[model samples]
Target: MPLNIDFQQIFLHLFNFIILALGLYLLLYRPVVAFMDKRQAHYEELDRQAAEKDAAAQQKLDAYDARLKAADEEIQRRNADANRQLEAKRQERLQRAQEQADKLVEEARKAAERERAAMLEGAKKDIAEMVVSAAGKLADKEIDPAADRALYDRFLEEAQAAQEDRP
Candidate 1:
C-alpha cells in the first residue's frame, strides 16, 4: 500500500498469463512434438528396409561368385579332356606312320632280294652255256695248245661284250 501496488490487478495479469501458456501448449507445442515423433519413426523404418535390401543383394552377389567359379572349373576340366584326346589321336597317327615305314622298308628289302636271285639264275645259265660251247669247240677242232688258247680268248671277249651291253 505504501509503494502504491494494486493486488487485484497483479492477480488478474497472473491468471491471464497462465491461460495463454496453457492455450499455446495445447494448440501448437503438442502437435509439433507429435509430428516430430512420427517423422523419426518413419526414418527409422526406411533405414531398416534399406539394410534388409543390402543384405539380400550381398547374398545374390555371393551366389553369383560361386556359380562363376564352378563354370571356370568346368571349362578347365573340359579343356584338359580335349587336350588328352588330341594327344591320344597324335600318338595313334604316329604309330600308324611308324608301322607304314617299317612295312615299306621290309618291302624294299624283299624286292632287292628277289632281284639278286634273278641275277644269280641268269649268271648260272650263261656260265653253263659257255662251258657247253667250249666243250663242243674243243671236240670239233684239233687239240693244239695254240689253237685252244686262241679259242678261249675269243669266248672271253664275247662274254665281256655281253656284260657291257646289259641294261
Candidate 2:
C-alpha cells in the first residue's frame, strides 16, 4: 500500500516459486545425481578390472622372458658341449693318423732292409760262381770236387779281406 504494490499477490507468487523448486528437485535433480553416481561407480569398476588385467599380462610377460633366458642358456651350454666333443674327436683322429703314418714308415724300413739282404745274398752267389769259373780256366784242368771247394773257400776269404782293407 505504500508504493501502490499488492502484498497478497506477492505472497502467492513466492509460494508458487517454492513449490516449483521442490518439484524440480524431486523429479529431475535427484534422478540426474543418482545416475551420475552410478556412472562414476561403473567407470571405477572398469578401471579396477583393467588394472588387474594389466598386472596379469605383466606377470605372463615376465614368465615368458624367464623361460626364454633359460632356453638361451641351455642352448649355449649344449653348443659348448658339442664343440668340446668335436674337438676331442678331431684330436683323436689326428692321433690315429700320426700312429698310422709311423707304422707305415716302420714297415717300409723293414721291407727295405729285407730286400737289401736278399740282394746281397744273390751277389755273393754270383761272385762265387765267377771266381770258380776263372780259377778253372787258369788251371786248364778238370779239378777234383774237394779241391774245387777248397779253392773257392780260399778265394772268398781273400776277396772279403780286400774289401775290408779298402776305404
Report the C-alpha lDDT of model 1 over 79-161, residue by residue, as the tens digit.
99999999999999999999999999999999988887887787678868998988997999889999988888988897777
Cand. 1 Cα-lDDT: 0.90
The local distance difference test score of model 2 is 0.87
Q: After superposition, how far is residue 23 of candidate 1 from its true place, in Å?
A: 3.5
Q: Model 1: which ten-residue window has the lowest total lDDT? A: 158-167
TM-score for each candidate, following the candidate numbering: 0.69, 0.70
**Count of steric clashes across candidates, in order:** 0, 0
For candidate 2, lDDT tens digit of each residue in 1-167? 87868989899999999999999999999999999999999999999999999999999999999999999999999999999999999999999999999999999999988877876776687677767776666589576888778776877787677556543
Superposed by TM-score, candidate 2 places the C-alpha of residue 160 at a distance from the truth, in angstroms, of: 19
On the 0 to 100 scale, the lDDT of residue 2 in model 2 is: 78
Whose lDDT is greatest here?
1
Which candidate number has the best TM-score? 2
| Candidate 1 ranges beyond 4 A from true positions | 1-18, 134-167
Model 2 residue 124 distance off true place after TM-score fit, in angstroms: 2.3
Q: Give the range of the ten consecutive residues with the poorest summed lDDT in model 2.
A: 158-167
